[model samples]
Target chain A: MNFIELTDQPIDVAKVLQSVSHPDAGGEVLFLGTTRQFTAYPDSKEQDRSGDAGGQHTAFLVYEAYREMALKQMERLAEQACQNWPLKSVALVHRLGKVMPQEASVAVAVSSPHREEAFQAAKWLIDSIKADVTIWKQENSPSEDAQWVHPTNSGAAHE
Target chain B: MIQIRLFAGATQLAGQSTVELSPTDLPTNPTVGDVANCLTARYPQLQSLAAKSRWAIGSEFVELDCPVESEHSLAMIPPVSGG
Candidate 1:
């Protein structure tokens, strides 16, 4: 019953945590991804070997996605996560538009009867979001290049 | 005619996000696959990306060949990198 699509805003993580907490839920897991100053140089072996300066300091990021479909994907992802784990509640929020370093980009919090299930399901949601959803990210790096990341044969931006 | 939309990079490639094209005029109501082919034909940059991209009928991701009626709002959704 909780899903959102929006630009930057003041987040209430504590509220989300409280909402999902229940007497039967013994463990809660949270995943927070802040904007790293540098883009995680993916394992592009050839790009690394070419030595085009591996540390690409990010200037800013442009995040975009197909909102309606992304929300639907999130629903499916949550369903899959819940199926895989005995979870009581799941809360996920993601930010879009230009975000600077050290800013929060996305967060996933899961409440379950145990910690392991919460942790595993949260991880799965984030990974599936990256691999499947039609969102795109364009990173403006100090390396003097801007790159667009997307899935092969897909239309979603890497937001 | 269905209203088709593109967003972000896909929009950039297409030069616009919303396009109204006649679906009934075609041999049959076009499918998501047909929309993709038409898009690629109009924008050559889409040729490579089309293989990986997906189409959405409303809130769900539908196969490229999923039949789309005239009133459906088809969307071209590229991958996103939101945290």
Candidate 2:
């Protein structure tokens, strides 16, 4: 029912999971999201320099969020999940500021009396965080240019 | 008095994180609409965005008529993207 948040550093999924663990909890699920190195359009000018095109595609992403609102929304979502699921604990951590490619962007850890609830709650928290939270990231790449990415059904490039 | 917060592009323009205004005498409480008008008076640049901008009293999104007092932190949140 409690969540801790910090705007700096990469998220430690294990630490978050551990912090929310409970004696009666029988299932734990952890989700970690990392920045992808490539732009939505891989063939664009912002291609990887090392030529390991398949490697992490992003250089750095600047993250901004409505801190207070995000916290409250997260709390509400956790409470809803607890009500709908038999969860003993739910912990979500998001990294703000500039995050490098391959670095963790967000983490959600949930512990419940059953694996089904834990899994479902973890997935729901991540999805809702992405869709509802007022956090934004501008992708920075090797070309010294940055682009703001917005969600699209086609997953098209934002440029 | 009601405190207004600036964020993202709005913060960049305001040059400060927070601004305080006296919407009305204390006790009856000032509504978000009153706060918006006060914001426009203080920052003319915000006049246009005020109509569409989301207002947050503390952490929750509130309507213009929601009663807000001096103690709450009112913030202007522009559109943002995050995952």
Candidate 3:
């Protein structure tokens, strides 16, 4: 079964993995994305606007989505992945609402008859979701006001 | 009337989640670009976003010049940040 969901609750990685488990599948790959304390916005001049150009700390991140659109796009991506790979199943879950540091915000699992296909599909699914989904994240920083992160511009920075 | 939904920073800038426009406000058989131009004119704050954002009819993203039906759901999607 193909599974797709957007929820306010924390993502259950194990459940997502189990949902894609199949006897016919020889390989399964899971990817987890967690909220981090440091985030950098390379495309935006927001850092300068906040007067904290050198340092920015994320207290938390609040995720929001155009729900119906996001779900539809996700389902489309899942279908595309399945068509591109010989897969057993696919599961994708993204968390909405406030996600604290170190909390899992998204999870993806893909199972296939071989490791290569599973790995490729898993990577493609996550990358496509990041690039195409209609979800947004607001980074709340202690030193500066909150900013809505632009998809292509922002990335987690190790503190 | 057509309702244009806004999300993320676009919503924050416009100070409203949705913008309503009468068909008379746009050109005949308005394209997505025409709708965007009308919105920017009505809400100058949306100008910058309108320039960069993608347009969506219902759940599908469309080209700026794509024809829009007044009855369809529309949204201005700022750059997505999903994981």
Worst ten-residue run, lDDT, model 1 chain B? B21-30
Q: Please identify model 3 stretches exceeding 4 Å from their true place.
A: A44-55, A151-159
List lDDT for all candidates, in order.
0.71, 0.73, 0.87
Candidate 1's residue-wise lDDT over A32-114, tens digit each?
A: 77776755454455355353544568887777767767777777777777787888888777677776777767778888998
Worst 10-residue lDDT window, candidate 1 chain A? A150-159
Better of 1 and 3 by DockQ: 3
Q: After superposition, how far is residue A37 of candidate 2 from its true place, in Å?
A: 2.4
Which residue pairs collide in model 2, if any? A37-A56, A37-A57, A37-A58, A38-A57, A135-B81, A136-B81
Query: How many residue pairs clash (N, CA or C atoms closer than 3 angstroms) in each of the candidate models, in the order given?
Result: 37, 6, 0
lDDT of 3 by residue, B2-83 (tens): 9999999999999999999999999998999999999999999888767768888978888888998889778998888888
TM-score of chain B of each: 0.84, 0.82, 0.95
Q: Per-candidate DockQ versus the true complex?
A: 0.53, 0.24, 0.62
Clashes, model 3? 0
Ranked by TM-score, top first: 3, 1, 2
Chain A TM-score of each candidate structure, as shown:
0.80, 0.82, 0.86
TM per candidate comes to: 0.83, 0.71, 0.91
Question: Which residue ranges in model 1 land beyond 4 Å of their true spot?
Answer: A1-7, A40-55, A142-147, A151-159
Question: Could you tell which candidate, 1 or 2, scores higher by lDDT?
Answer: 2
